[model samples]
Target: MEAVEEVAAPQVRQCPECGTEVTVHVRYVSWCAACDWNVDPGAPDPDRGRLAQVRRRLARRYGEQLAEEVARGGSAAGRVGADRSTVLAFGLALLVHGVTAGLFLAAAVLIIGGWHTGIQPVLGGLLLVAVAVLLPRPGRLPQGAPLLYRADAPGLFGLVDEVGAAVGTAGVHAVVVDASANAGVRTYGFRGRRVMFLGLGLWEILTPQERVALLGHELGHFANGDVRSSFVTHGALRTLGAWHSFLVPASRGNLMDWLLNTLLFLPRWAVYGLIHVLDGLTMRASQRAEYLADAGAARAGSAGAAVALLDRLLISEGVEAHLRRESVTAARAGGGSGGREAREAAERELWERLAARIGSVPESEYERLRRVSARRGHSVDDTHPPTHLRRRCLASADPRPARVVCDGPRARSIAAELAPARAALARQVIRDHAG
Candidate 1:
């Protein structure tokens, strides 16, 4: 009997049910083995000049993105603020407070032992603890990651890819929608590179063009690493600041002890004031980061888009609805059914109120624009800067299409503009790293 020719186990057209790749005879039904992700392998219909423009932009900008490379060392792990670092800072602060306490206790012992000299040292140590506890500790820093999307329209994602490539950074990894109706980056995790919370309010309220621009703005954050740095900074401060509450009272008690526990209890108001100052600084830093990210997005061939997104976001009720919906959804997900329902009802009421306001638009050009916008499924209420102000800024900037080219000169200019920020961040990185 002739041995039957062995066939290679009837090689399937799809990947092994456990692998990530596969041999596909047709492009339409490719499947992944790793996680059961069946994908359409057919080439995407050609994007009418969009991908080409992105390629051109990337080609034009790649060389000038040297500054991004410099920033990579600090942001490389794609993790923003290290929670361990934060914990350490808090621990050190605690140790300092402990030492201060020990010194005071020793002073008391000495006082009882008739040795007066230790009293001043004890008071000084107590003062040091007071300062440590009263000063605002640093907060978590921001980390940047490539924007990734599983739910956005392909067109939108394609545009984001273009912008990301042009800006000379890794592409985005997640879609971060800040349901807070606030146009800002929302961060979590030690390496703040988790999600790009694009406010759903922006999506529910802006024109397609405006939505595109808002996405461009977020891409701006990715390119700049502002998101990551911001997270790290905030985390660092918060961690340190938390130690203050623990130390302030103990130090106060020590002072009271020195005064025979009768001089006066220093109100906790001073500690509160310190925290406020720290929060203000963090806010200011965040604002600056926003501006820079906006600028970067504008440079990525979508100044008008960014402008439109900002404008619509400022005046869209859809943003409010989106926020309310997210809150309800989150509440429900967290098992708070009754609370979620109440919030959803409240959101519906707010939407009705906003509709009434828009209905008041007189029969004029603004009304026509409103109708056109409605037809386009766009909203005007957003969470960031006001529309009028954003429009004015874009107008004053006079950003032309030609300027969007990430050419050598443009890159150099961007790098130069970012140098100071980068330097400051480098210092921070060093400090954090050393710590």
Candidate 2:
């Protein structure tokens, strides 16, 4: 008997909604990264969507340029001029604070010396009061901060330590697990010890390799010294904001009050403008630092894994939105009888759907996502680069073999270890949602 001939998958020319190349798997329904367009192979094409088509075309062109840049050995590596930028940002932060301090000291000296008598003394006193009110209070750790329960996952902590060592940092001081769809490392305490917060929602969706990539990216921020400069600049900006808030008069009062407010207004406005400028500068530095951290992630894992982690993050955002909608719908239907349990069940269902969707994402589609994400620029205040730009940077970097091992068994063990903390956090989230 003749062997049955194997059929090749059909080639997808363009997305019915958006004109992006659907590269592989034309037979199956696929998602377009450019416009979130879903292509149904068996369904009839709807009306021609010109706007999405135009956008996709522009995105493809831009992506090609970025790819060419990567090929030409562009400076996608995080190390290029990162140290200089960090140093400059830190120095500027110090200089701004130093100048403010000098002014305060000079004002104090004048006030104490009794250089101005009579009304001058009264004005000086008012000035001192204003300054004191405007001064920024030292930041304190939140009373119940380190919000998530400390993970009992020794394997997870060991993985973190491996990544930390790879990045040349001592290691995180603590590891906390939460139920939210996020992961980050923060500096805490007077000593500025690093604390890693791992979100179970994010963890549940990621593959073992992607988990390493996420951890590496967060730890990379500390390894690259992003937190220190960020803290200083952010503190300075907050102080300026406090000054602006206090100096602005809430209402017109007596003639003397009005006069004093008028006198303070210009300086306060100047401070506000300075804050905007400084914040913009620091934001740029922060964006650069993010790219550096992405590079560090690439170093800790493979370039492919780093990029895949970003893609999963974007996918997870969509999943979260869907989960929230489901929660609201379920709550409305059941009159919120089961509360947390119902929500948890819905969450589980949503996660299963998310996992299936992630598993079905094609390589070509992920690449398209990288390109499209790069085309969209962030606002001035945003600290991170666009996801596509981050992916592009990672793609340009040399692929590194991951040092830590996180196979299926290991991943399961880690999850099991954190089960208690995850359950507690999940309950908290459900309660918060119900309320």
Candidate 3:
């Protein structure tokens, strides 16, 4: 008897909206390129609130404009001068600073001039407390991450220094390692000393060259000197946050309390408006700065590597989820009272396991990430432009060869330097997740 023939279903399907033929993947969203159907599969976060919604709208609008401009003519769109928005942003920041200064002067007068009046001291003390709350705190290095100096990790520092030079900036003064699925650079303390934070989760998954791309993008922030990161703007934002917290009226209790809150309504919302407008202005500049940084990424790590870096970032959510699962598994496997053995075993296979998962990602998955990113206007945050635009900008730019190359010896040396930090971080992860 002849056996019945079996047929496998095709991966292609029709879009419900446009009826256009589209290919579906088991692990990725299937979308119609022509109609953009299913391009945005994720739902919005209801808890993100109104302020977040406004910021995302601004990011999407400006990001699309910049993307088009970059596509048409590369550098000119990126060279947007301090426009009206920038001016307003700075003015608003200065106003915030001026308020802090005004508070100080008022407190001094009340305390010094009214020495004969007993109540003046009490009022002055309250004002001084207000001053302290409103004062702009400088950036601080993270306490959790282990620090590394140039001497301790010469190979890593040297590579960063090279990337910095390529991007036309001095390298970081110190390096700190963390277990996050991200990397960043920031000023440390009042002196504005530069420090770079390397996240092991993302770093472990990157090839040597992609790591260069990561460095390039971060150092590029320094070279470009994005307005939002400046002390003036950042300080203003922080101060605004403080003001918001301080002004939040207590819940209704009494008529006098209600009356007091009624009086504060204007001031409270006035600060709120400043926060929104200030963010609007600086966020635009920050997005533009991102394009400039992408250029630096291309120059330092090659256009291809830069694009690949963005693609890698697209899948970082998945990477984070995988890490959480791995953490739980590791905790369970440790099998001891404190799961000490589990921590050790997880650390032993941590990187290898992560690398294997990332390496096995199919091409279709990357494509899906790009599409979803485009539709949802995905970015690292409001400080960054959309990832799709970043990719497009890199693709449109003239192809560039890598300025800093990571060789086998240096890579090994750097890994060796990171060993202790990695182990400590692994143990910490297990401890946090262990049941």
Candidate 4:
């Protein structure tokens, strides 16, 4: 149950007529309070207004469903609920691994046993060896392992430990800071050790309270046992994908090659189809795990902060897009060595502008986001629930007050500790964009 990143929430905007902040209304229409400016002029269309109302009703209904599920102590209640689909997915993954392991074992036996036998056994051994070689190796950490920097900041580690303890999970084995705009926890290493990655993009935008909620949400995944199952399933999927690729015929050379390709096609197709089915089956449970983690976050911080964190993610999405565009534009404008610095400066400027804009966003916009998200519903590929459903579920759940462990000063210390790595990553990003 690695934490899955949710869609970015809605962004805040200023009044178009004047520079004054605007208020968002139903259907996400913006109006200037000061000068009577409206982003959508004229009276709110009744049809659009009705659609908004319908969206709200759907969100509320979904929220109620989630609340009732929580009340009934279903899968949403905690991490201990035994989900059959998850178990099935895990079992299927183990089955796939077992089959791969058997192939290797069979190859070993053929090679060893054939030493005293005739050439037939040796030929069989060689064939098995070739088959094993062709099979895709299990997915592992990337070379050089981007974003795997160890967190040495005492304050940051202390806060992480506190959050883990609060959420009833073993403390993370390591913390990583990445350049991406998302945070997640995944199990790594031979022993399935949990590692948490905090995105710098996400970090820059969040307030201390919101950050706490985010951390809690991630740590909660480990606490609920989602990490282990998710890691296994992910590994299995990767193995299956590799097998599929290997079985695909690169060329139709000779009769034997065609025969081999034809023989492998059915199995590969079956594995591919099985992967999709297992993925669909397990998706609901994965989503429930998300809601459970959200509940943990609500308990660790406040529901309000949890909801605000989701909103800020949307703002981060917009800011990230703008930054990338600006960086590329600057590089292409012939700034050369100075272009990198200019891009970084532009990034900082955009962040500040976006952060300021967050305050001016009308509450109605948040509601609109929730409504739209609710109406959209969950897709098979979605790892997290709709933002509005999450908000509603959190609002309905009981709240627990907790102190904010990673406040501004401590967060600053952490940024300072990781400054070198962040700088290196920034350069890499600049090069990537420029190239």
Which prediction has the highest lDDT against the true structure?
3
274, model 4: CA deviation in Å? Answer: 1.8
The reply for model 4, stretches above 4 Å from the true place, is: 1-68, 116-151, 227-231, 249-262, 329-365, 378-381
Global lDDT of model 4: 0.64
Residue pairs in candidate 2 whose N, alpha carbon or C atoms collide under 3 angstroms: none
Residue-level lDDT of model 4, residues 90-198, one tens digit each, is 7888887777778777777766777677774677677586556544343244344244333456666777778888888766767776667788887676677777887
lDDT of 3 by residue, 266-306 (tens): 99999899888888888778888888888888889899999
Arrange candidates, best TM-score first. 3, 4, 2, 1
**Lowest summed lDDT over 10 consecutive residues: which window, candidate 3?**
1-10
CA RMSD of all predictions: 23.5, 8.8, 5.5, 8.6
How much is the lDDT of residue 290 in candidate 2? 70
Q: Which segments of candidate 2 are over 4 A away from where they belong?
A: 1-88, 103-151, 227-231, 249-262, 329-371, 378-381
Give lDDT: candidate 1, residue 377. Answer: 27
Off by over 4 Å in 3: 1-41, 44-51, 74-81, 336-342
In order, what lDDT does every prediction score? 0.43, 0.62, 0.83, 0.64
Query: How many clashes in each structure?
Result: 60, 0, 1, 4
TM-score of each: 0.40, 0.70, 0.89, 0.74
Task: Compare the candidates by TM-score and give the number of the best one.
Answer: 3
